[model samples]
Target: MKTYFRLLSFARPIGRYAIPYVIYTLLAVLFGALNLALLAPLLTTLFGQHENAAAIAKPEHFYDVFKMLNYYSMKINAEHGLFRTLQFVCLTIVVSVLIGNIFRYLSERTMENLRIHTLLNLREAVFNNVMDLHLGYFNEERKGNIIAKIAADVQVVQYTVTGTLQVIFKEPLTLLTYLVMLFIISYKLTLASMVIIPIAGFIISRIVSRLKEQAAAAHTSYGTMISYLEEALGGIKIIKAFNATPYIKKRFHEENLHYSGIMRSMTRRQHMASPVSETLGIVMVSGIVLYGGSLVLSNNGSLNAAAFIAYIALFSQIMRPAKAISTSFSNIHSGLAAGERVLALIDQQSQIKDAPDAKPVHQFREAIRFEQVGFAYNERMVLNHVSLTIPKGKSIALVGPSGAGKSTLMDLIPRFIEPQSGAILIDGQNIGSVTTDSLRALMGIVNQESILFNDTIFNNIAFGKPGATMEEVEAAARIANAHDFILATEQGYQTNIGDKGVKLSGGQRQRICIARAVLNNPPIMLLDEATSALDTESEKMVQDALNNLMKNRTSLVIAHRLSTIQNADHIIVLDNGNIVEQGTHVQLLEQDGLYRKLIEMQTFSAN
Candidate 1:
């Protein structure tokens, strides 16, 4: 119940829909039960048993509904004849049904609106929270599980939460209305029949006891299957290259079969509740008929033929709502399980957030100082006591072997991950004291992997600047050496680059990335091995573009090729998370240290 109520909070200002729905549903239920209560009067009129017809008077109390209807029905029959009274009764039934159905329709439409509103809010909240989470969360969690929470689990919560509300409000009102009519007609029979209800409820409860557990497992299994699907699609190239199609298929098929088995089990249990409740209802009805018929046969109670028949009719409909309530219990279990997963995601707190007194950074006038900085991953230190300064309008190149914490250091500049100890200052102001958005806005990045979207070449280049014009994008492209090839495409700048620019070649994709960075034109540029992944000719073109992008910008370059950074104004050599050398490229070469050895090795490998 706690989980259920928490999920419902997404439906803010619920009274906007609830008030009208309650009004319509109450009217519908009242008229619906009144139709059944009028059956006795109709039967009495048909039998010509108008013993008190001449003395028929208006009922003094409106609560004596059956008497009022019977008295008027009899008075009409005596004066206007049997055919007219029968016609009048039939017309009343028709009108009652019409009004009842109309209100029911209105209530349903209102509920549908509420359902749609709740779905919109819930899905938006989950997706927005996901986007706000820190980068480390994505590394620790599976993509498929996140997708399931946003798409599938949220959908389940929509139906479950709204459906439970209907069951809570509308169904019980209908059941109560029917029960009141039955009690008014014959209290004895209604009391006797009440015994079977608890028994039926008890049986249904036992049958669905394990549903919540199974539902939770089924949700997990489905998420795993989705994960397998994502992995297969994303890694199709590798699977084909290694000829592992059969293994992948078999693995996926096994999880699919397990999911189907759990669903089959859950469906079996869900389908059983309805039939069991219905059969119990039939047994109770039989008991009511036998007991009420015996009373009519003997001169025992206030029960008469007409009223007793109506009582039996009203009692029979009690199971429909009863069955609905029982079925809802089973369905709510699934909903609550899914709701927990969604709420868990919404509750996730990002490790990185703006400080309470954080201020926005506007300009880059001086150097970025890493002051005795340290970072680690689960006690495995990635960087230890590292300190370096990247001066404004100067190029600093990071050269090192693998596992030298180069990428980690660059990530810290953007506050992608916070350091364990010490501080990083931008122009003597702590970066942590600045708002992340403003801090990131001062820098442009081009990574080894060209992160282009499946969009037009124009849109991809002008991504950061939303309202950039054709001239600006074209100029950026020309600066990055991408303008000539972009025009060679069939659509020129409007061509849709297929997923991650799969439509373009290696060199074209990298230049597009550089063009995007150039368009941003920030004071600081971080280029992480931007040309390492290209072929010889592609690398030369991409290197030329990088040079254009780095001109007059405070640039941090991570170079894999020894030849690329030999002219860097200042070179920092990192090994085992410490800066072993720092000087101009020629000065480092003359020292014959780690920098010289790396250059010699790369020179040897190239030859």
Candidate 2:
């Protein structure tokens, strides 16, 4: 319940829609009640004894008694001499129903607008927070879970918040208006009719509580299934090569079964809500009929038969709202559980945030320096008291075995993960004192995998700088050696890259990524094994392009092939998160330390 209240805050920004929906709903309910209340006079005019004619002629008297009945006596009485009056009353009822439905439609339209507006803002908020979170958070959490929260969880919240207002507010207003009309008819009978309401409400409350538990389980099962499917598809090649199709199928089936079981339980409980409430209402109606019939018989001289029958019709009208309320409560409870999940995601605070006094950095000069830097993932230290400096317009290379944290070191340069203890300075200004966006904007990164979106070749190349002219895109592509191939394709630069650029070869995709990086023209470049995925011929071309690209920029290279970084101004050899050796290529080899041993190992392997 508390979670639901928190979720409602998202709707606060869109209260313009909610306020009008409330007003429209109330108007709809008023008309609906008017339709029911107008029935009494028509009943008296048609079915009352001739001696009651004078009373029937006075619509006020007939209206008072008509509001007292619990059934459809008005239609029954319309069968006699008062046929014209019945026609008029039926026309009014039709008009009221039409107006009620109109307001109902407007209310729904408003709610839908609110849902879409809130959902868009929610997705934006979640994606923005993801960009701001520390890299360590990703190490401990699955990408699939975060995807589910933004996509599925956010959708759940939209549906629940919209449905909650409709069911809890609109339906209850409709029910309450009818109850007041019932009270005006005969206070005694209206009080009697409500005897079963508390019991029905209690039963509905119990069912809804259980439904919420099942709903929460069902939502969790959905997220788990999505995670499993994501993992299976992401590793489809491995699964197929190992003939693990049956294993994956079994796992999927188990998850589906669990999801189905919870949904079935919740559905059964929800289905019973309306029927159980209706049955109790029927029992209450039976009591009204017997008790009200006794009153008619005992007071036969005073009571008009048509008026008594009219009161019975009015009593039955009250049950519709009661039943609706019962069903709505069940839905609201289920929705609240989903709402809680969405609110939790929206409320998540990033561990890394810009400093209160942060400012945008516009230029780079001097050098980037790491002063007594240390970093950890969870409790395991990855970088310990590490300090380094790279002057502007120089090239530095990091070479190490896998898990030696070469990539982690480069990640720190970009502030992807903040150092646990120490500071990184860009041009003597602490990196933490500048906005992350401005900091990253001044650097370009190209990773080994060549990440590319499923878009046109032109769009992918222009992604680094949106709105780049076709000529500018072509120029960048030419520098990266991708222009000739792009023009040779059937669609030229307009050709689609397919999912993750799978339609392009490893070399083509890498060159396209290079083009994107070139288009940015940042002063700082971080190359994470950029040539590792290319063939020998492609590697030569890309390395030449990179050599030209790195000429005057401050470059940080994470190298896989030892020979590639021999010309680097400085080479840092790392092992177990600590720098073991640092110097020029020949100088490090002469030191006869870790760098010398690594060079000898590579030379031996090649021979």
Candidate 3:
């Protein structure tokens, strides 16, 4: 019950959708009770009681119902006029059925609106939280699990919560109204019937408790399976090349088997609830019939036959609501687990957020400086007491072996990862003092692997400047040497690049990324081995474009091939997160240190 209450909290903000639903559900329940209650008078009339004798007699004592019926039947010629009364009874029953169906329709429509609105908000909030999470969170969490929370788990919450609320409020009211009708017919019989309700409820409570545990386990297993599948698909090419298909298949099978096992347990528990509840209802109904018949026979006219028959009908109606309520509890338990997951994500506070008094910078000028910067991934240091200064409009090249912290240092410029022990000053202002959005707006980055969407070439380039005119987009593409290739295609700038630009060659994709960065025209540019993956011809073409793009911008280049940055204003060599050499390309070679070894290796590899 506590878990269910927690789950309902997710619907609080969207209560407008739910409020109307509650009203309609109540109205529906009322109509359902009215439908059953109408039958009581009809049955009395059909039994040939006098038309004016309070056919649906309100019971004063248990015997008043039976005495009045017996007295009226002796005077009225019921056998002669039975068909006329039967016709009126059937007409009233039809009207009652019509009302029940109409109410049911209204309840269903209301639930639809609530379900759609609640799930929509929930999905949006989860996705927005994912986007705002710190980069470090992604490094630790699986992307597939996050997606599952947004897609699958959210849907589960929608159906479970809305359905549970509907049943809890609507069905109980229905049961209550029917119980009232039963009491009116025979108070003693109604009380006798209720004796079995608690026992059935206790049994259902035990079953649903176990079901909740299995439901939580099932959701976890499903999430794990999705995560594994996503990982396998993302690396399928490597798996195939290495002939590791059997290994991945075995892993997937294991997850699937585990998921299946949990689902089987959950289903078994869920299926038991309805039958056990209904069977108990039957036993109770039989008891009511035997006890009421004994009272009638022993007391000799103590029970009115017509009212007793109506009471039995009302008692039977209880079984469905009882079954529905038990099932709804199981669903509520499952939904609570999913609700907890979504709330956990929404409640996650980003480690990097703007300070209350943070200011936004409109322009950037002067030098960018990193002073005594230190950073770590867990306990392992990636950057140690690093310091560097690059004047405005100068190109600085970072040359290092792999794992030498070149990329890590570049990431700090955009505040993607903050340093633990130092401050980065952009244009003489500490970047920490400015809003992250404002700080990142002053920079552009192009990585070795180009990231493009499945959209038109024009849209991909225009992504950097969302409102850029076609002329501005064309000019930027020309600067990156991509305009000619783009125009050579059938649809030119309008051509779709397919998924992640897989439709383009490696060099072509790299140029598209460069064109995107060029369109931004930021004051600072960070290039992370941007040309290392290209062939000789493509590298030359891209290098020329990069040279043009670097002009008059404060650029930070992470270069693998030393020749690419031979003309840089200042070149810094790093080894094990420490700067080992700093000077011009020629000056660094003169020292014959790590820089010279790298140049010698690249020169040998090129030959």
Best by TM-score: 1
User: RMSD of candidate 2 to the true fold?
Assistant: 3.7
In model 2, what is the error at residue 140, expressed in angstroms? 2.2
- List the candidate 3 regions with Cα displacement exceeding 4 Å: 1-15, 49-84, 298-302, 603-607
Candidate 2's displacement at residue 410, Å, is 0.5
Residues 1-607 of candidate 1 have per-residue lDDT tens digits of 8998887887877999999999999999998888888798899888746665778677898888788889889888878888898899889989999999999999999999998999999899899999998898998998998998899999999898789999899989999989888888888889999988888999999999998899888888889889999999989999999999999999999999999999999999999999999899989999999999988889665888988888887887778889889999989999999999999999999999999999999999999999999999888888899999898999998888888888888989999899999899999999999999999999999998989998999999999999999999999999899999999999999999999999999999999999999897899999888888889999989989988998999999888886568768899888878999999978998999998998888721110
Instruction: Give each model's whole-structure lDDT.
Output: 0.89, 0.77, 0.81
Candidate 2 wrong stretches, greater than 4 Å: 13-15, 50-83, 301-304, 603-607
Q: Which of candidates 1 and 2 reaches a greater lDDT?
A: 1
lDDT of 3 by residue, 1-607 (tens): 6655655665656567667767766777766765665555566665644654334444456534334433344334244465655565567568767877776787788777767777777788889988998888888888877887888889899899877777877788888877776776678998888888899899989987876677778777788888888988878899999999999999889989988998888888888998999899889989999998887677566576666776777788878888899999877778888877877888887888888898998887789899999988899888899999989999999988877888889888888888999899987888889999988888888997889999999999999688999999999999999999999987999999998898898888988998899897888899988888889998988898899889889899988776679999999888788888899988998999988898888731110
- lDDT by residue (405-461, candidate 2, tens digit) is 788888887788778898999999999999988999989888988899999999999
Q: Which ten residues in a row have the lowest lDDT in candidate 3?
A: 68-77
* lDDT pick, better of 2 and 3: 3
Model 3, residue 205: C-alpha shift (Å)? 1.7
